[model samples]
Every structure is written in structure tokens, then in C-alpha cells.
Target chain A: MAAAAAERERVPFTFSAAGLDHPHIHSMVQGLLDAGAQLMHIYDENPDQANALRAKFQTGQVVQELSAILHSEVDLVATSIVPSKRGALGVQVLEHDKHFLSAKAPFTTMAQLHAAEDAVRRSGKKWAVFYSERLAVEAALLADGIVQEGLIGELFQLTGSGPHRLQAETRPAWFFDPGKNGGILCDIGSHQIEQLLHYARCKDAKVLHSKVANYAHPQYGDWQDFGDATLVTDTGVSQYFRVDWFTPEGLRVWGDGRTVLHGTNGFVELRKYTDVARSAVGDHLYVVTDEEEIYFPAKGKVGIPYFRQLIDDCVLGTETAMSQEHTFRAAALAIQAQEQAISLTKAGERR
Target chain B: MAAAAAERERVPFTFSAAGLDHPHIHSMVQGLLDAGAQLMHIYDENPDQANALRAKFQTGQVVQELSAILHSEVDLVATSIVPSKRGALGVQVLEHDKHFLSAKAPFTTMAQLHAAEDAVRRSGKKWAVFYSERLAVEAALLADGIVQEGLIGELFQLTGSGPHRLQAETRPAWFFDPGKNGGILCDIGSHQIEQLLHYARCKDAKVLHSKVANYAHPQYGDWQDFGDATLVTDTGVSQYFRVDWFTPEGLRVWGDGRTVLHGTNGFVELRKYTDVARSAVGDHLYVVTDEEEIYFPAKGKVGIPYFRQLIDDCVLGTETAMSQEHTFRAAALAIQAQEQAISLTKAGERR
Candidate 1:
């Protein structure tokens, strides 16, 4: 471990997978460290991994151990364990379940999620989500690009959707329980909600309408599938979104997935489709003017690699990174939509 | 006049004007007829002008003489004219006002001016307005071009402003009476209101807010000199208009002077500034687009000459030249705004 740390430092960074418990997190940390990350503070609450690492490392030489990883002094923090539930009481536990199920999960509720967010805010640091990293990057890029490039003339509408499918083989049984914020709406819808608000450039948005349903993975015996929502802003722009657990074509992820913006001079449409089952993809963004249509391919490095970008942005003081405050708004919107969808379902049932 | 009518009749169409007792009504009728229109019917309580025409020609012609004027059969309907301090009452009177105003003063109100708009269903006729004869031609050309080109997009916002300055020496005293619907906000504002509603393509638009004030032209004595009004539609579009009796330049006899439209992709601004003070100089229109601006010389036409176009479209069973429903909607919006302005003024005074 000491020799590995020395070798990593020689190249400019050290990767100590001391705190992270997930294999993906460990691999990502190793890749960044190998590519020249100066320091990495991987953390998890599991003591067995910490003790195992201590046995393999020299005392006061490599892989420093900390009592609590998040509370420790670290230049950057990356976590994939955000709780999926977003409301009061049982929400935090449900979110934790979702985090375990989804590989890298977002903080469950806004309040608990605010710990890392507040840290970023107080320290003026940048952070990124690891699981839905492409979306995180897309949200940041589109928000900045629209304002910078004057694309889409004026954003009129934004829509997003996520997978409603949940695997029964996933060990976390609490993942399917709504009481623990285990529903697909709260888990995946949160990401979309955040992205929509971000792209719309809205300061404060209120949910205009929403709908949610449970369709697939009935064995989980919970409402974790088929959620759709829409919102309108004070500026007259509208946003719509949907998330389904039982999509037959595997996981499809898109940034600026399906967007239509009507401007004074013309319009723009951005459509992205990814077939996770085949690992195949197709995407296109077209801006239609009065006389012509301009198209651009959306191709980039995929996944939560944006986490590294967030870390780099924080360390380097770059203006391009997405802020926690920005993500929080999306989170809030998602939670609001989820609650609204449930209310709508109840109202519809009543009618 | 007979010779001219005979010469015109040799062709497929003819136009002629007959005198009426009241200058206002005569001016209105003659204006329509002189524009190459065939008068189908005439109904007036005052038969003096008709009698004088008959005696002058020794034709024994009267209001009933209109039957002879029409080569084909004509429809003649007569109703008693009642002078009420409260102005014309009932939906029929308002509906008539709309038709007459559109035909005689296309820049004025449409049939929807009646308070009973709720009872009238849209018949989908094109109702075009022209502040002056020159503008009428240009607008006619544009409408024809749009129709020929099928350049149809959703109309967004339309705005217009006509001169407020009325010639006191030539104007009747009743023209200044607000109770008789003679105020600038009603007369001129009505034209703008109609234009806006048509441009915005809104239906059943309720006035959300309005402000009206008389700020200039104190010298007009009994008549208010200036009127400024603003209205917001339920769909979120806003409109503002101002009318002044004194535009440092001389009185404008034709065209409301300026109009503008803002669409999704671009904007169109039309301005007609006549050397009204100079030797009966003709007015000209300037159209500005996002890419370029051009001026079109107005031949001596002053109103929407599209009555023929409307008639032709009706005969051909095609879409009307303009949207009558939109015209009525605009008029309704203007009236509602005017009422709101009055209410606001009262509220302000109480404060």
C-alpha cells in the first residue's frame, strides 16, 4: 500500500481506497489516481474494510484512517450513497436503500442531503453525483450552454424521464418500500426534476401537474414504477417528465433527452436515446430556423465521470463546474413532483 | 357619377357613391362605395339625401332606390334609430356597429363590440382593419401574399396606435362625448385592441390588468386629449397603446400611424407617417423585419379594401382573408381594458 501510494504521488496524485466500499467507486478512484490525482479520500462506515486496509498499510505512512470520512478535512468529497426518499421521517432510510440498490445513489432527502451540499456551499466547493453522472454533466453543460450560446432562443420547455425498473436480485429489500422512500418516482424522478429546473433557468418553480404509477416488479410489492410529471414556470415555460421501472428496452439515458423550445425566430429540438441493454446509442440536437435546420451530434465520455470533473473544478477554482445549490433545486422539484403525483393518483381514484 | 358607374359596370365590377343626409353616415357610406364596392342595400331613417338625389337625377329614387342600384335583387331592412344617452343598446346594435365600423372604419370596432359577445359564436371570417387607404392596400397585399404562400404560423402579438388628434373645426360636437363612445381610448384604442387580439391569436381573452389616462391635449376642451391604455391577456401576453390629440406634427387623416407584431421567430413593425399637414400628401408604409426594412408607397387607399377579398373568399368557400373571430376578440379585449381603466381611475381618485 505504501509503495502504491508512493508510486501514485510520484505521478502527481495518490489514490487511497480507504473509505469507499463499492467496487465501482474503488475502480473510479484508482483510475483517477493512476491518471495523476494527487489525493483521494475514499470513505464508508464499514469497519471491516477499514481494518483490513490498516493491516496491509504501514503506520503513519500511507492510507490515513479517519473516524468519519465526510467530517474529515479533505480537498474534495465524492459519494454515491445519497438516500432516494425525499420527505420527512422514513424518507432518509428509504433513500439509503435506493442508494444501495442503484450502485451510486443520491442523498435521500433534501435536509440530510444538505450536509454534503452545505459543506460545498460553505467551502465553495464543487460536487457531482456519481451514479447518474451523465445527467449531472448534461444538466450543468446545458444550463451553461443555453445562457452562453443563446441556443434554443429562449427555453420554452424541458422534459426528462428515467427507468422505472428495479431488479429483484438486488439485495436491499428496503428498496421497494415506499415508506423508506423506495419508490421509483422518488429514486429516479429526483434526478430528472433537478435537471429540468436547472435547464429551465428558473429560480423558483412550482409543480403544475404530476402523475405516478407502479407497473413492473410487482414482486417487490410496492409502488416503484411509472411516474410522470409536468411543471410550468412564472415565465410561461413548461416542463414535463416521466420515469418507468419496467421499460422493456433496458435503461435509456439521455441529456436534453427530448426538448422543444419555441423562439421568436425559430425552434430547437434535442432528442437522445441510449439502449443500455445493447450498450448502443443514438442522439441528435437540431435547431430549426426559418430557412434551415442545424444539427449537432451529442457524443461525450459517459457515466458519472463528471465526479472527477467536479473534483477538478473544485481544486482548480474553475467556473464551469455545477454547484450543489443548482442540484438542490432539481432535487426539490423532483420531491415535489413525487408528492404531487401521489396526490393526483389519490384524487383520480376518488373521482 | 353615372358615367363613371357605367364605365366601371362595362367591366366585371363598378363603384359609385350616393349622398346621405348626415355627413357622418354619408362619409361612412361614400367611403365604402368609392372603394369600388357595389352597394347591395341601404337603410336610413333620413330620406332627405335620397330624395335630393332622386330629384337631381329625376329618377324618383329613395332609400328604396337601392333596389334599382343593385342589378340583382337586394335585401332592404329598416329599423328606427333611437337616440339614447346610454348609447346603442342590445346585441344587435353592437353587432351592427361591428360590421359598419369594420366596413366604413376598419380601424374601429367589430361586431363583437356588443356586450353580448358571450352569445355570439365565431363564424371564422377574416376581419381586416386599415387606419388609412394606403395602409389598407399594403395590408391587403401582405394578406394576399401570406394566403398565396401559405405562410401560416401561430400569431403571437399584434399592436397598433392611431392618432388621437381630431380636427375640432371639422368634427361634430358629439364626437367628443365619452357617453357616446367618442373618447380616444374607445375610438382609437378599440382599433389597437382588435389588432392585438388578432395578433396574439387568443380566444375569449379576459383582461388581466389595465391602466388608462388622459395626459395631453387639454385644449380640446370638452373632449379628452390623450388616452393611454395597457392590457394583459390570460395567456400572459401584454399590450400597451397610447393616443394623443396633439402629435406636434399636423393632423393625420389616414392610418392609425403605426403597428407592430412580435412572433415566435421574428418581429414585424409597420409605420405609416403621413405629411398630414402638407398638401393632402399621401401616406406611406414602412415594414421592418428582423433582417431588413422596406418602405412601400401607399397609393391613395385608406382602409382595408379587403372587403372584396372577404367577399371573394366567402363566394369561393375558402378561408376568409382575415380572422373575424380574432377581430372580435381584440375588440372585446379593448372594451374590457377600457372599462378596467375607468375602474382603476375611480380607484385612484378614491385613494
Candidate 2:
């Protein structure tokens, strides 16, 4: 015990950054660095992206190649690469004897998800997903305790709405390509699916129905701006979620993401991003129970604990941060939802 | 115009109350009375119920037989009878050359709905339904104007949640009988389905999926306490609704019903019954658009106009209050959902 404590004090958990395709890599790195993890190296096809990250933290070497980070002395490698490439990259990281963490929708296709699952089994390395909507949002974290305490009783239904602004001109070419970035369900809907799995505490669920539509963005061929799906677990816990790239420019935030939990006793609603006209601050949790009706503004009060747990999970080969199975299942369900989605655009045309 | 105005002043629209199986008959009578409609007669199988209506209104003679009201000169007949009997009652009233207004879930089954439709066509008399959730609620009334003004843009999605406390002890025996009262979807779920149809501005939609569960009340045998369904209009406008009987005792109101509408430019959310933790005063409408975020507490500001319009429609042989087709379609869709519903209790058993 003394030796373990001495080692902890002697050297901190170290990780390298690879493929800064998504902006989420900044938060993922910052969260780990805040949790006392050392950032060793960074790499991106765009040198400016790697340099920008290095400048932001004033740490980590701007490496020239992906191989350099893959063969590094780091405990884990985190990436926010093009989603279709992420599955192969995760396999490569695991083969090189390091854990892998990727921005969600960890894989764009079912085949990719299958390969990643196989990689985790063969290499015995953790494959964690940065489901920041739940892990990083304070209101969601607060709701976790409320739900687990049986304050609301057994959860029976969940609904999630994620509306994101599409700054169409600013996005990369790959954003509209389904093969590169995945469809709307696989991309943004993954966050909602992950939270449902986490809060319901269930392993398996069946997708009942899913649909996608290109409501207003006809310029981007075959690019859907809206997607929704319904799923139910074996225990009859049902979930419905809608994700859209239709946030108007007049909104104050990037999105107005909300989650609602309906339980046997009462219900809980989380205004994760903003409370609209009421308040600009996020993490607004409104809970109604048998005892009381309460509103908890939990913005700064609850810190993100997932980062520290992930660091420990990487170093000790533990499953505390998130289970390997859950990471794959969430991604797999999203891919299934995307693959099976019926086109609503055709229905719209009939009108 | 002068003669019509003079005639309107001379003779107020008159109606008689027939069935008192549901308590909504009280509000139906009160609204019309307040709107200057004369309550001529009241009849129920239970004399005490008729006497209660007479005592509350200080008008409306308690008639002993249904034939007295049917043969009377009353222009319209409003009834809140047992749901399964309502369609037949409506047909009888129409055959007597009087407009019929029944409490919603106007028919218990598709066959009953078809009978009512035929009666309307044959007699050339109106068969209206009192969808009081939207007709009487002030916030819903307020939302109608806002939506018509195109402030939120073209609506693409709507979600309605209606939760009612199950005071099972106080309810009549027929309340739990699916054959007598219709299933939960055809009963309470009709309110949500009506609102969705009205807001989506579409006549027909497909029920993609539906499910019901006896979550907490198993003693009530096949009496589902929870139900939810997904539907979509031909215009690609999607809707989802969940109705339940799990409102806990601590709530200040009977239920905390809510409705949300997502449009092209923004979204609108209505806290119809109570805004928990905020105020007991209901009719809270929150509007989030491209230009502003605003909240409107519309309890006393908007009056129930459906009563007056319904009275006018009955007297003038006009379709003004609500289209006959819309009323029948709402009930038909709810019945379809109930019939096609998958039993969620079976799925719960697997867990």
C-alpha cells in the first residue's frame, strides 16, 4: 500500500492526444489535465490543430506522426478523429498496448463497432467513450444521485432532446458526409442513448423504431438534419430521443439539450444547456417527488469525476470510469438506429 | 343582419344535459351557461346526479326520462355517459334532429366510431366532442394564437404528456373495464392525441408504434396505468405522447400535464396544469424563438370560447367550433393506438 501511494505521488497518469478532428478533444484533454494527468504528446494531420492544442495548455510535444503517439510511453491515447476512422485507430492503439478513449459516436458502422469490440477482447485494453453530455454536465451528474437514491423510484421512461446549431459554412467537408461523420442519429444521438443506458442500468435494449429527415438542408445531399428513435429495455424501460441540426441563430447557446426521467413515484427534468429566458446558466435540474418539488442549479457545485476515474481505470486496468461493453453497446445501438431509420423526407413530399 | 341580431337577442341557444357518468358534465354545463346558453333540462339514471346539477346551476329542471329531453325543443344535447354507450347515445340525439356533444373518447371502439360517423352523415346533424384539455385550458388557448401568428415558424414536432392521479377508490367500477370505458389510450390518451392532431395541422397520421403497461396497478387486471405512442403526419410532422395514472399524492394539483412543440424557428412548451416548484397557478406557456424567450401565465387572460362557438354551430348548422372530421379522426386514432398497442407488461416480465 505504501509503495502504491509512493508511486502515485512519484508519477502521475500520462496520456497522449491523437487526431483532433472534433472540438471535444479540448475538453477531454482539459478534464484529464485538471485531474492531474500528464499530457505527453499530441498529433494531428493538420499541424496547426496540434499546435493550437499545445498552445492552449502550454504542454505536450506537437508530434509529426500518428505512429509516434501510438508507440509512446503514455498510459492511454485519446482521439477525436473522423468518426469512421476512429474504430481502426482504437484497434491500433490497443494493439500497441495502450487504452483508447474516443469522442462519441465511437464508430460509424456496425462492422467498425464489431472490430472495436474484438480489439478490446483480444488486447484486454479499456475502450472508453467521452459521453460528455452525461459525464461532464453537472445537472446530469446530480440527477444520477437523485435517481439512484430511489427518490423518484424505478425509472420507466426517458426522453432526450438535443438541438444543435449547424454553422454550415464553418464545418469541415466531412461533417455532411454520412460515411465520414455518421448520420445524425449515430453522431449526436449517441449521447442520449448512452445516458439512457447509464441511468436505466441495463445492458440490452431493442430499437422499436427510428426515422431521419432532411427537413431544410437540401443543399447537402443525403445529409439528414433531424433524427429520432425509440428503444425499450427488457425491463420495459422505454426511451425516445430526437436530435436536430436546426437550432436557429437567435439562440443564446449552441443547443438546448434536455433530458426527462419518468419514474414510478415522480419525475425529473434536466435543462442541461440553458434555462432559456429564466437563466443563461446551465445545469438546471427540476425534480418532482412525493416529498417536494425542487429546482437545483448545479453548475459549478458538482465537478466532473469521470476524468479522474478514467485515468485510474487506464493505469490499473480497472472498469471504474465506464465498462467496455457499455462503450460498444451505446455506439452499436446508435449505428443500428441510423442504419434502420426510415426516410421521413418521402413522407413530407406526399403532403 | 339586424333581424339576425334581434333574433339572437330574443332566443339564446338552448341545450340539455343527458348523461352524468363523468364529472366533466359539470364543467360542460358551466361553460355553456357562462357563454349565455340556456340549460333547459337535466337527466341521468341516478336522480341524485340530476339533482346535484340542478342544485349547482340553480336552473335546469330535473327530468325523469331521456325521452323528455329528446322530444323537447332543446337545440343541442351534451352528455358525459359511459364511454361505450356514448356513440349510441350520440346517434339517438342526432336522429331526433339535435346536435350531440359528448365527453371525449367519444366512442370506445372502431365500430362505435363508424356508427357515429354514419349517424352524422344520415341526420345532417353535428356530433362534437369536448376535448377539454385544449378547449378549456388557458395556456393551450394562448398557444393557438401564437402558433397561428407564425412566431415559432412551421411546426415539425410535438410532444404531449398527460398524467392524472388515479384515485382508484373514488372512481366507478366501469372506469377499470376496458370494454365499458375503453383502454387507457382510447380514454385519457385521446386528449393528447387530439392536441397533437390540432397542432400538427394535419387531418390524418399513422400510428407507427404504441405500447401500454400496468406498471403499478396490477389489481385492476389488464387495466394499464401507463401508455405511450408515436405518430407522424404525411407532412413529416411527428408527435409523441405518454399518458399515465402514476401521479403521486404529494402533488398540489391532480396532474402536471405538459405539451411541447418544436417548430422550424423555435419551440414552445406549455405547463398546462401546474408549474411545479414555481407556482400552483397553471397555464404556464414558455416560448423560445429566434428573437426572444418569453413566458406567459395565461390563467385568467383567455376565456373558453369553444362553448360559445359550439352553441352557435348547433343553432346555425355551421361548422365553426371544431370540424366534425377532426373530432372523429382523433377518437379513431386513439382507438387504433389502443387496439395495436403491444403489452409492455410482457416485456417487463423478461427482466
Candidate 3:
């Protein structure tokens, strides 16, 4: 009883879940709950989704409206609403004196991005994003630690291949709408950009080139099935990433996402989702340095520490989870890439 | 004895080695020899190089001058001369009524490319290039067959990562001169473009964006150690490739070259040189199709039929090895990328 009281006294962190539009919300809330944060409330316009969240957590008082979550005594509000609404909701959460945790791509438009920035600056509250590809995946976390330790020397290049299956029939109408889901580069490609930024240890980078194409998905109406971008940092490190909705049905996983990091001394490759024919296992990391070649299977052992760090950041007014600037910069870069992306579908006509 | 004579009569291909500059000439010559082509003569400005070629082959006669081979009865002249001079050499060989096989980047400048094209048109002689990365690598050959068989469906994208060790101390002085070496993209990047074009079944591709950086190699005097480019084909199949001279000394091979081909029904990845930590063995191919996932270790199994095909093409006026148009297009695309490459080293100054 004394220990329980001391635990609550030592770290008083409470958060609520709102806008359960994406399945990612489950993992996001579960991470915080696992970190011992109290779930204060749950809200979604869809009663089924709200009920689902309540049943999963078996906690959180169900709320009827978004205003209720905003008005609640929660320290933070986590949301995975329609991507275009995420930035606005973040602004509202901050205006109510609560920190915000958002699913990426956090903002579908530049105006929303700016508004969120203004709200955070004016309210002095955290605005964090869940870039689960890097933060939640154990192999990525392990690679980050290895890179930080200089095991592979000065990192200079990163190449990411993010391929996701397009379960078009199961998706909501807004998922196919570019304004709501953001472009492919802004949506799935954000995960790549964020991971590259964190791994390269850069404050900012220039988007040298970007392109998007509908390819075989003209039926989806303005939906891009393929996108790629190249970016370079002031320190001269470079990144190239490609995201597409063509993951074959034979793969055991939804995608076989992979990344290769080039360093001065050696290189590292992360088979994030699956190692293809070698094994059905994901989180396979291959590290090659001057002294040795190492293979690390990062499953079950390396825990996701981002959630705990984020909770502490909210409670203690810190930036350990991720710097507010880094989060904002990643979001902005994705938006810029989307805004400036050339259309490959018009290549023949342009020529 | 009759079978041996019949085999000799069946192939009846004669070739000579000239302009022994880069060591790629060794393999270029060996592939032909393995394909039962006769090495008639060898010539180089440097007598020591000519002697080295003669010693390696233990066959070709060491000619005193280029004219000896150019004016001789040799059917084809294979050369890995200085990059800038290759086009002129090809023109001369073609004008002399002999088929010309030059090591890639084939030509350094647009003027040279134009001159070579004119020569080929006038002389009606073949001007082939040895893109050994795709031609000689067994795994690549296997993947080509797989794609040709429609196992991967309609290929739409290719990504290549080519990293090479500089070994500056051992390199000739011409290598550090951008003008002489044809820059990074026109040189090593040609291999990537060639492979991508071959895999994607693209005859021509526009260089969407390209950049080169000296990064860590300014001491080498205008030597670009890194280059990357994005290209899109007329059919909308896209390609992105990066070539660098930063292969760490730790790697067992010269570089860890990899290529990934994304198709409608599946994807194929070629670990050409080494599979990093997993194995020192090269030619590891991973195939993920709609029906099954397969792995192919192609060492000593898949024979390189390119040299034999080239010999047949020369003898019978067939385009079996690689079409004349495809060869020229790959070379032209690489030169175009090099010609338009942006310098990333000056990015900070520009900003």
C-alpha cells in the first residue's frame, strides 16, 4: 500500500484516447497504459470505436463528444483521427492546457502544421508524434542505439523501402481521399523520413527531390500508390526512400519494410517486417563494422521505451521522448515533400 | 576429336584485347575466352600492361601498336581504355570494319557519344558495352531469367545500391580527374542504370534528378566519391540508384552491391557481391512472388551467356547479347545524369 502510494506520488501521468480512426490507436494507447499512465477518458464520434477502445483498455470513462476529452482533467490526449483533422485537434488539445500525442502523418496541410506550432508555442505544451516504424520496432531501436554508440562510425546515408499492402476494400472513404489521408509521401513516407532523421542525427534536411504516382490505382481517384524522395542534410548525409502500396499477397506480413544505413566504417540493414525467404521473423538487423559482422534478431527483448519517455516528458516538462523541434521538423518536411512532389503519372504527357 | 572440331566450328568467334587500362579488361577478356572466342592480339600504349595481358591470357600476341590490331583480321576488339577516349577508339575500330566492345561508361561526353553513334551508323558495325554487373553476376542473370519468365509480373521499379572502395593510392592519376574519368555517375553509376534498364525492360529513361558530392575526397581533386540519380521510363517504371566510393575496408569484397526489382505480382532482390553478415558468398537472390518465396544461390551455377551471345551477334548480325539500342540508351542516360548532376558539396554555400 505504501509502495503503490509512492509510485503514484513519484510519477503522476494520465492520458486519454480520442479519435480512434486508425488501428494504430490501439497500440499507441496500449504503449502508454503499459508504461503505467492512467487512462482518463475515451472519445470518438463512432460509438462502436469508442466502445471497442473501452473494452480493450477496460478503463477510461466513455465520453460523448470531443469537447469532453478536451475539457477533461487528462494530462495528454492521444489521437489518430482523420489525418487532416489531427493538426487541428492537436491545437485544441494544447489550447486546453494539455499535451498532445498524434499519429503520423500529423498534418495534411501546411496551415494546420503552422496552427499546431502556434498552439504549442503559446501554450507551452508538448506535441509529440508516434512514428511507430522506428520507435515501436525493436530492430530500429537497436539500430539507433548502435549508431549512437558509433559502432558503424559516422553515418552518411540511409535508404528505406517501405511497401504496404493496399487492402482497399477494407479502408474508409477518407483513407482514399488525398486531403484526408495526405499523399503517400506524407503518410507512409513520413515514417521513413522520421526514422532517417533520428538515425542521421540531424536537426533538419533539404528535400532535394520528390515524386508521386498513381501507377495502377487510378480507380482510387487521386490516390497515389507509389512515392519516393531524396533528401540531404547540412552535414552531407543523404537519404532516399520509397513507399508504395504494392506489397504482394504471398508475404506473411503486411509489408517487407527494409532500411540500409551507410556509415564511414561499415553499414547496417534492418529487415523490419520480415526477412523474406530466410525466415518468417521480423526485426532482423545486420551490422557490418571494421572489426566484425553481426546479426541481431531483435524480437521480444528490446522494449519500446518511447511511451515511458513520453509520459515522463509530459509529467516533468522534458523532451526525452523526442524533442518538440524534431517532431515538428519531421512533420513539416513530410508536408513539404508532399507539396513539392512531381507527378510521375504525367511523365509521358509532359515529355 | 570430331565433337571438339564441331564445337570450334560452331562458335568460330575471334577477338583481341586492346587498350588495357582498367582491370575490368581481364574479366571482359575471360568471359569471351570462356565462351570459346579466340584471343588473337593484345596492344597497349604501355608495354608492361600489354605484357600483363599476354601473361594472363598466355595466348594473345603482344602487338607493338594499336594499328596492328585495328588493321588486323580480328573480328572484334575489346578495350577498357581511358573513359574519355573510349568513344573515339570505338569509332576507329568500327571504321576499320571490326566490332567494338568497350568497357562502360563507354564515353565521357555528349560529343563522344554522338561521334560513336555516327560511326556505328556509318560503319554498320556493332558497338557493345560490357556491363559486367548485370552480365557477369550470376544472381543478376538468374533474376533476369525470372523476370523474363513473367514470374514477377510487370516490373515497374528498380532500386540499386552500388558502393565501391576508392583505393586511391592504387588508382591511376586519371581516376581523380573528373574530365578523364567521366565523373562518378557516368562511371560506376552506369552499371546501376544498365542493370535497372535491363531488369525494368526499359529502352530509355529520363534522368529526373541527379547529384554528386566529393564528400571526404576533396583531396583527390574534383573526384566525386558519391553520386545518386532518379530516373523514370517511358512506360512509367521508375529507378533510383546510388553509387559511392566509400566501401569500408572491412568488407570481404570490393563492395556490397544490391538491386531490388519491384513488380506487380512480386519483388526480387539481388545481393550481388555479399549478403553482409549472413554469408561471404555472393550472388544471393531473394524472390517473393504471389505464389511462393524462393532463395537462389547462383554461384557457379548460372552461366553468363552474354559473351557468347555477343560473339554470335557479331558473327550473325543478331542482337541477342543486348540490343544495340539498349546499350546506347543506357550509356546515354548515364552521361545525361552526369551532365546534369548537381553538386551537393556547395549546398551550404547556396543556402
On TM-score, the leading prediction is: 2
TM-score: model 1 vs. ground truth: 0.41
Candidate 1 chain A lDDT trough over 10 residues, lowest sum:
A93-102
For A1-351, candidate 2 gives per-residue lDDT tens digits of 344335556887789999999999999999989888889999999999999999999999999999998877798899999999999999999999898889988999888888888888899888899999999999999998999999888898898999998988889989999889999999999998998899999997888889888777777878888899989886779898999987766678888899999888988899998987788779999898987888889999988889888877766667877888888889989999999998878423423
Q: Whole-model lDDT for model 3 versus the true structure?
A: 0.87
Interface RMSD of each: 20.7, 2.0, 2.8
Candidate 3 residue-wise lDDT, B1-351, digit = tens: 344346558766788888988999999999889888899999999999999989988998999989998888888999999999899999999999999999998999989989988998999899999998898899998888888998888787899999998888889988888899999999999998888778777677899999987766656756787889999987788899999987877787888999998987889999999987778889999999888888889999978788878877777677989988899889999999998998877422222
Off by over 4 Å in 2: A1-6, A346-351, B1-6, B346-351
DockQ for model 1 equals 0.02
Clash list (residue pairs), candidate 2: none
Evaluated at residue A335, the lDDT of candidate 3 is 89
Of all native A–B interface contacts, model 1 reproduces a fraction of 0.00
What TM-scores do the predictions have?
Answer: 0.41, 0.97, 0.96
Ranking the candidates on TM-score from highest down gives 2, 3, 1
Q: Rate residue A289 of model 2 by lDDT.
A: 91
Clashes of each: 39, 0, 0
Worst 10 residues of 1 chain B by lDDT: B75-84
Ranking 1 against 3 by lDDT, winner: 3
Q: Give the CAPRI class of candidate 1.
A: incorrect
Q: Give residue B249's error in model 2 in angstroms.
A: 2.0
